[model samples]
Target: MVEQADSRATSFKNILLLIADDLGKNLGCYGAEVTTPNIDKFATEGVLFSHAFTSTASCSNSRSVIYTGLHTHQSGQYGLAGKAHHFVIFDHVKTSPAFFGEQGYLTGLIGKVHVGPDYSYPWHVRNESATRDVAWVADQAGEFFDKAKAAEQPFFLTVGYIDPHRDMTRSGFGNSEIFDARIKDIPYEPSSIKVPAYINNLDESRFEFSEYYSSISRLDQGIGLILESLKARGLEDDTLVVFLSDNGPPFLNSKTTLYDPGVRLPFIVRNPKAAVKGIENPNMVSYVDIFPTFLEWTGKTQHAPTILAGQSIFPILEKSELVPESEWKHRVFGSHTFHEVTNYWPTRFLRTRRYKYHRNVAWRLDFPFSADLYGSLTWDAIRHSQPRGKEGDILVGQRKLSDYIFRPPEELYDLDEDPLELVNLAVDEKHKERLLEFRGLLEKWQDETLDPWLYRDGVSKRFIQHHLDAGMIVPDRFDLDLENIRIR
Candidate 1:
């Protein structure tokens, strides 16, 4: 253990991780709706990361990356259901707590352990639990903190809340009053949400946007409760608090898509011992870096399990003058696996500070809307109750790919000009040089990462068919050669 003077002098620094499900930059602190005083307080007091991103967009894959410090390809988690097939930080790498636990620190997790099935791992703590309710999570966390305090053990507690995620059939939709009263005045209409010109502006697209904002407000309230509990327990100052979402916001072109809203998340870290306070860092940081950062903060000596794809932001947090400019500037690479129950294909992206490039190998397949399964049920039941005609038609139609593929195989977006990714510069001869540069970058990343199915859709297609034949998995609509036909 490489104990620093300050770290050893003080009672061990406890870690409190609060993760919200499907949360985007829609809070007051992030320049959007929903007044999250607790989160805002943490932002005001801590290091606010402007460019922090998840390795993947989907929940399970992103969480796995955060836990393991490995990319999706390395971990083998392509989507939510793929949790069973992958290696998590809890499974492969030495977890922050296990290392700290060996050093006499108590560790526990509460609320939403969606990483894998009920499988055992190296750092698995039997004390951890998960729940969808916010109040219950706060109570459980309070109890855990109290227990850790009683034992006089330094602690690492993770609290995950399932909010802002698309509401399940029975899980009552967003809190209407909270949305109408607190956020309705925000001048954001479904029409105001400029969808990419290439995207089909179906009626369902507008309704989805409205529902997404409602969910954001609901999640904010849950975060407020957790923060209050921490303060009541007197663990605020001693604990190094980190507030981040598991993945990007769930929306049409975001959650499963390799875009900014899908991968970029609000990262706020508040450590009382750090020299810097209330600073907005534009450095590109990934979830993988978190493992090393936590260890470094606690004055522990440990390297990432493999060559980490992420770099630590401890220097930025401490306001160290010795920190190099190169350390802060780095491109973030993102990957996505088969989302929903179907084999919708996979995509990989590279995002620099000013630009973003996407290489969708499975460009032939349509965007799979996982919410459609639940939405169809609701639409059918309330067909007569809600608006009819085009509005209802859009809501009830099958999830199909839009006409964006008419352009080019590759996509190049100047994030500065088009944050929403409205324009594709891949075919523009003026930017051919930039397109080639990013394409080369993406290809290099794919090869180096050992992406299992990169440019190998035939391999994935065969794998899916093999699984179906062997009774390993089954789909509603089975087609061995899906590339030749449009099932929906």
Candidate 2:
């Protein structure tokens, strides 16, 4: 299924952005024991990013980063968008659809449009459904493409596949339901599937992952079907096809946490006209870079009015030579405040080539769970692994469950030494200076991003900035200590 790329064109006109829900780096291209031939073929057609990361590990928040080129803290979609969560994006935030739609491009989205206010993402065509019938989704996309062809308008279509994400039933990833005939059911043996290091390899875990693999392959079939539509329309030579996941897998350690396994998901781009094709990019690219990259692809004539925070990676994508490490940003940052309305643990992270740092604002609070993760059979495996009394010895992967829930205010891991992020170097005296360096860098980012959760003396510094302007002084600590309570 590997189609040849057209290397002659200098730029792309049509854009196809595909987002997979609750997917991690489990594809064949990423060298995992899984079935994703279509996506892997697509990777060979252009570039595969080895170290791409989402700004947040939650679905709505991560998508907001892509749509607006701003962090969740910046976009105001601090949690889930549906039901009682009811989190909506700020009206002021300029979105991708708004940018492309204004320039007379035909924009559309089919399936799983999570981030909202509805008005902010003004897609010309939208059929939001949770159906795993990817062929039906492709049919919808083809219809939009046909309309675009009829109008002779360039198209920007996003297909958000609700694949591999845990179903509301919590039993499986919609694998029991029969899908379209065009979709392939890639049934994997539970013993053959590679269990991630972050979770225990219980029989229940293996079974769930097998289901997840099938759902992922089903999602892959949709990619091929949609590409066939493009091929039929002769858009293959000039279109930019991008594929990424909203977050990590729906397992316990991956989904809601700011850990590398959570945020560092697969990001593949198949730019047909790029000078460089079939290369694995090692740069630490963030989701924020995407909006600006697409804007640049729109060309100078379109005139992007809104200034986006992410820098365009067009140079790296287009040029024959790889962008020097000095030229590219080597680190990525993440912010996670909530998953659902009830899961409010504001944490920010800075991951560099060498080390990773996490600043948990509400460290005293027990780490809350996204409902799906809580109810997952995998959680049942972990929680009931031991007898009633010995919880401390119970390990969620390598880290203890108690340590996982009750984390320190700061955590520093030399990624080279502790790639699994097991040992907390923040509590060690040897790495104090290195920890401070990363902490300062993270705080500076929080300041730059206007993050209100950047706390001092148990309160948001941005929240009390006016008070500080009035010449009030507070402790420089992240939280208040009753022992050192400030006196007015």
Candidate 1: Cα lDDT at 1: 37
What does candidate 2's lDDT look like per residue over 93-134, in tens digits?
888888899888889999999989999999999889989999
Q: State candidate 2's TM-score.
A: 0.95
After the best TM-score superposition of candidate 1, give how far the Cα of residue 466 lies from its true spot, in angstroms: 24
| TM-scores of the models, in the order given | 0.76, 0.95
Runs in model 1 lying further than 4 Å from the true structure: 1-10, 82-103, 117-132, 170-215, 318-325, 372-401, 404-408, 456-488
- Cα deviation of 332, candidate 2, in Å: 1.1
- Worst ten-residue run, lDDT, model 1? 396-405
CA displacement after TM-score superposition, residue 413 of candidate 2 (Å): 0.8
Residue 52 alpha-carbon offset, candidate 2, angstroms: 0.1
lDDT of 1 by residue, 1-488 (tens): 33443344247678888887877776778776454666777787888888888877777778767765678777665667433334333345444545666766777777667665344222324444433455566667788877776666678887766666666543333433232232332223566553323223445545555556555655665566667787786677788888899876555455666778778889998887776788787777888788777877777645435555666677666442334656564688878775554645577888888898987766667556665333533333433343444433432222222332222357888989988675788889999999889887876777677666554324543335556577654332212356654333
Residue 345 error, candidate 2, Å: 0.4
Global lDDT of each candidate: 0.64, 0.86
